[model samples]
Target: MAFLLFLLCLILVIFTVTTMGVPNIPSLDPVNRFLKGQTDVSKIVSSDFQEFFYDQTLDHFNYRPESYTTFQQRYYINYKWWGGASNNAPIFAYLGAESPIDDALWSIGFLPENAPRFNALLVYMEHRFYGQSNPVGSMEAPNMVDAMEKSLENPDTRGYFNSAQALADYAELLLYLKNQLQAHNSPIIVIGGSYGGMLASWFRLKYPHIALGALASSAPILYFENLTPPDGYYSVVTQDFKEASQNCYTTIKQSWDVIDQLATTPSGLAYLSQKFQTCSPLSNADELKNYLKSVYSNAAQYDAPPNYPTARICQGIDGASDATDILDRIFAGVVAYMPGMSCYVTSPEVVSPSESVSQTSIGWEWQTCSELLIPLGITSEDSMFQSLPYDANVFIDNCVRSFGVGPRPHWVTTYYGGQDIKLILSKFGSNIIFSNGLRDPYSIGGVLENISENIVAIKTTEGSHCLDILSSGEADPEWLVKQRKDEANIIDRWFAEYYRNFRLL
Candidate 1:
């Protein structure tokens, strides 16, 4: 009884709710997600891009008087590697996603590293309602926790935060920059990873006049419209652990039932909670399951080389002695991520599907409820997660209840033409590069084959989200090194073609 009493006290005293904590922040892409709340922006080994603001239309499609209100949109530009408009050096625009543009400036290693070679002007535009570009008066204030919660909860402020509005912002921004710099002849290559990658590809498709090509990394554009199998995402995650060790995979697969069984009684719940070092004693099994799912999802997303997360987790699980229970071994895996968390935060703040990826989950949650409806589930025994079917009713109910907004399920596929993507893009698309790594859960929905001569697809068996865009070093696997080289060569050809055509004129 004394030991149990001690454990309960430890749970209460050890953790306080950290709204901006590492686990609570959500991200649009794996790169941002992996580095969320963890990286010091100034200390990151990245080149600088000067910050600027532009007056942006509140609602590009709405002509109402209220819609004409202008907001200060934040953006960044770098001229260090720019070859002058007279020489026609290309321009590279990286569209920001759900997170602050500041995160991308330091994390996206591709643009700065390759800029000098292409003599490119680097630009990054912040998405509306995120970071300093927000229409909310206090969006950039130090007290962002309260500001984000209030803004995200109000649907009125979120009404204009959709893809079409954002794309138009980029379209106008790019043209304005071109005019300002007098680089009309310069070919524009829009580069993006993850959600931004989708924007880059869609930008090329919708507004070909603006950008010459797109380099989309790990962009699961096909995740919508039943274009890819529903089980694809979970399958890859299960496969990652299974590949790491069958014992690890089987242990995870069994731990769910064990958790459920344990939560059935008070003593059992207390024991479970004390064992896992929960922020509070377990009342039910929901929070525990949610935390595990997040850990697995993120581990699979950013499973890069040099002490990969999955390996670290599997080592903890598989290394346990026979005297230890399966739950202890599983808790060991959790400890791999929360090495110092005496009381794990299993609240919705940390493990809620939406909040798990962003510092503020409101904008992204709305986006998912609005248009980015990519349904993922784990049904087959092939996966380590629970048998949750992709039920639209459940998802819709959850979205409407949470955000007072409902999702447009079929809208994206109907608009984007995903039914026969190869044929659709083959005839119309050119110079776009779709880079996918099969290990990435999102890559199952990615373009993995060449659609046409110039509409290229680059795949690597050993890569994950934005591997090609990550900073290169001697420690990089040969496949990744070659992937970036090939991407550079392809971009070089694009510039050569543009310069050659301009010279003819």
Candidate 2:
């Protein structure tokens, strides 16, 4: 009894020391001060060198407007010289996808790192409810993953994930960084891909003053309202298959109709239905049918090529070993955004037929459509949608829409209206560069082709999905010099012109 009492006393003392001794301050100022004079900025100059270090604790300026509840957030500072810094080389702030910024897998050098001319700053900010950023109680209980699933299950909660809120958070971070680093004069260039691309565009639109220029590659500018399922998404899939067939001409042309026929067959329908049922939360056929219909109607890609490889899977037959199987195989190979968290299962409860089928169909159709077809296009879309064989529409929708307000006017109806890019360029004007690949399935050269006087739509015969290096690989050195080299050069020139010569409206 005495020993037990003594142990209890010791445990209490440890808890008190941990909880009270250190204020759980999540910020960067303290760490910044510690490194103020330790690392020589002079020797650290240049972009070619990329290094990583841990800033144990960085201050994150947490704030709350009257609109929402107060929450604490953390921001970690990661700096790497782009190359020996020039007299006034700009600073490129690279924001990664849903993954943490510190993960080396998502490095900026998707291309070769040559003479670096900018300072790449990676800000590791936790996506709401992800990593250490969960505002509510423990992530273990109603944890980040579970919370996301719950949000997806509830339609009302899904609306919260908009681009506007995300931009606001980024703006807060930028303002904090400017004051903290004392970089008032430094030109800021913001770059991101996929969801990160959406953030970059929003950042440019909402906080133009903070960024000198912006690069949003493979970004999904249209994600709200008009987004539909199956058919809408299949249109892109069909186009991708056609393109891939053309590329591998001898292998797969004129086969899509046959595959389509197979898909509707008893075995084909049963296979897909089973896959959907197994992967989703549907209990009845009607719900499954509605889900399939919705998928066919709204969630398809429009800008991909007619013959990409991934899209070709849709052209296979649907028997026990037909097109559906091909789709399964292809989907298996595609890289998904969320692996740890199931993108398909949004709720903990088993999906009901009404809720399960409708939502599952929409989510699956959109995602399957994207994953099955988008890669076939020369340039990939900023975002790819794939139906997880699970009922995760609730979670997926929340992450996509709620993470931010999404692009203004939205990309879905805009593309069909032929007014999407035009509307955005009209507002932002000359500061934007719409770059694309000629063979790209989505937007195919259409995005840049529609460029108005102010915005520059750059198309490279080789540049697909912002992958200048891969696209330029096949070109002659001279042709590349004439075509691809000028793309970046033009971007640099445009920046100089804008900052040095032009005035904003």
Candidate 3:
């Protein structure tokens, strides 16, 4: 699994528990409350925004040409007519990530900013099996166990939720939109960040005719074998903290030792539970370690504009009295992040038998188990934390137990042409902008250099994962402001070329 994507699931799970106020149930309708009409959507999005539900084929790759399952895929559209409404206006579409589409629309300001400039109708397409889009059934379930069982009970349904299939869904939706708006000549520009970025780039590869180009920000497309080193992800995480405050990094490493030493005795475990204010008792020492790792990983991954939580966390560590107190403050910060919520899960059964597991982990776990499976773990030398081997067998065992399917680790690389990716892009890809931040842990697994005249890569200095595409105003760092501007310029150029080529034809 891409550690960054895993962390996002973790964050969303916590967000749902703390803020969303969603009751535990077999199925949930997260969008109906917000989906009334254009007038209602205007309150959630901008005044011109309109919420929609388009029926999409459940399995785009289904061999049977005549029959298929269909679900009403949720999407939002804003035809603001920035440069006057016309069939020729391009479409700026967001390929939603593992998170909710509405969240992404609200959080990512770049899309809204650039849509008008391109004379584009803005669209945010929710990924199937996530957010309001549910293929097999509703997203909410009685529990994780039930969800897993139901997801894999029908092997055919399990086959439908992958990157390749999702790209096809995007293409189908684009065609549907073209027909609905009578904009067959309108060009489309796909935009995404993180896993969404990966989809955007792949969409260009698989369906270039549908999408003129893609703005893929901080996309870790090269995380597969023969493309990136296994240790690269965690090493970058360590560097982010070390850059902020080396003393804080050393303290975190030392605190792991303290945590391990304390976990040996029941009294020590009780003390930890009391100090950290864990939702449950400290039963599994390894789970505690995983929770701690997530703290650092989350801080580092989201260490960007608005509030630099990573820097604040490091400052807290530096300002603490001693090593033990340092650990206490760090845990306190985690608790503070989710105030008045029992967000941490103690049991192994619910959380996929690993510290990295979450309530939403099963959905992502199945994908990693089926494809896009990448090994990422902590180590003593490569990372600032204590050594912990990435147990591939454990992941396989859990996958088998949960989904009755084991991971095909090389499937993504094999299917997508791993190391030959550069060549693939050069020969076939164009009008794609791959943007990455130097501070981002996942940047190494992305396109850091320009591959060709059209397939461009923009690396940001002092920027975190997908920072350039995230919501930013005057408060953003100087570098990020400039990076966003550069990205916009490149996207404009791609649209220009697309129009030029279209006119020529």
Candidate 4:
């Protein structure tokens, strides 16, 4: 009876592989491809492709192949088998951020090893213009800026760089892979972080038919405006500066009131002006005032410690002359210095109008708040920058409308805000999960406030930035172990229950 069963399983495997159009496994090395001593039953397959089609825009009338075709698209598919010898496996497609592919692979350690077979698909679609993906004719800043501006103004041209189009491209790639691998019946899981996280949410909403589950980490869901600095961001910066001063420097903390009071004095104004002039972007007197004027309008939000790293703002020293002070560092010389090694000034002659607006409207807000107001103790004009709050209207207008390509779709999925998730999950019957860090400065308990039945928010004591950091040894070891356990358990149970029962409605 046992021998008969073995023979039947072998026949089923053959049939499954043939149906999928997958290459057949040779009899000589059949054992190598199947689970043996290990309790887990899974296999890994690698493939290389010359190129894949991507939608450049929302208008069906326009299309263009991604310009840089030098790098071959390489991916890995992991398969988890059932108890039988047949080749039935689920799939999990991971879309990582700007980091290298190797780092993304390492992050997958959070997945369960004992679970059923699954596929892990990796795509090397370098972010639009970065790395090998530069599509503009000239790499110069002026030319690049002009292209971006043109894209924003013309829908036909805007399709390639927008997030909506990127999501569509991924959907197309999945269909092609399904046909190529003959795995149309398999379930797929989509996951990502940062920008990749944004893509993951967009994919779930745009192509719900293809995905069983999605995990979006540190994703900024709303439009670009919401992500930009607002008045609240300036308030947060002030609070952070005040707190840091109190904690790190006794004199500053005790005399914080004096700093504010001094702003009224002419000598104080002169002193501050001198300090700002030294750090201005241009040495010219006229240019310095213009930059400072713009700074008042474009301040960033310093909401929490995680999003606003102390290194980015507060200096670890005392005294007005300390180079660590925000004023000294940002305006000590003719050119203004901002965090992240970016500058406030640009050559107007070569700047693209669209690129100029994006930088001025969104990027400047964050930079100004962080670099100017907090240090100077000045009031912010935009209120949203103070805290990471959930304003659906603001999110819709600033995040979705500003950064999205083409028109808004009917369905939407977001994982960043508990309030947003609650509302979305309740209305759409969607799955929402919050994978948070205890130490994360942003979105603290923000994921749990209005959770719906379909939403689940999980907290990791040591989790940071989409649970990317581990708790053990390196940065936080204990937190790492908890994160690993949580991830493994989540994936294992999800596969055992939800994935095993998934079917097209």
Off by over 4 Å in 4: 1-90, 96-119, 123-155, 159-161, 222-315, 318-424, 437-446, 459-464, 467-473, 502-505
Alpha-carbon lDDT, every model: 0.75, 0.36, 0.67, 0.37
Order of candidates by TM-score, top first? 1, 3, 4, 2
Per residue, candidate 1 scores C-alpha lDDT tens digits across 1-505 of 3222111111100011222211221244636342222222333534556889999988888778989888888999999899989988899899888767776776677898899899999998988877777776563456444555656766777788888889999999999989998988889999988888988899999889999989998888898756877778888989989888899999999899998888887588788878888876656676677667777767776777655667878988887746368999998887774465446646655532123434335566678778888877667877898887677777777778778878899988776667798898888888889998877788888999999999899998878778787555556778888999999999899888877887898
Order of quality (lDDT): 1, 3, 4, 2
Q: List the candidates' TM-scores in order.
A: 0.90, 0.52, 0.85, 0.52
Top model by TM-score, which number? 1
Whichever of 3 and 4 has more lDDT, that candidate is 3
C-alpha lDDT of candidate 4 relative to the true structure? 0.37
Question: Which model is ahead, 1 or 4, in terms of TM-score?
Answer: 1
- Best candidate (score: lDDT): 1
lDDT of 3 by residue, 1-505 (tens): 2222212222232211111111111101111111111121222346677899988887766568533768768899887854433648888889986645776656567878877677778889988776557664455455444544466567766777788878888999998888887788888889888778988888887888899889998888888756776667778879888888877777777777778788887698887877776667877566666666655665666666555556766766666646457567666555433334444534433431223333244565566667876666555484787665566677677668757788888888776665777776788778889998777777778888888899999987677667676555556667778888998898788768777987899
Candidate 2's residue-wise lDDT over 337-442, tens digit each?
1122232221212222112222222222222222211111112231122222222343234324533322232333343232455765676554544555443333
Model 3 lDDT at residue 298: 58
Residue 137 of model 3 has an lDDT of 48
TM-score of 1: 0.90
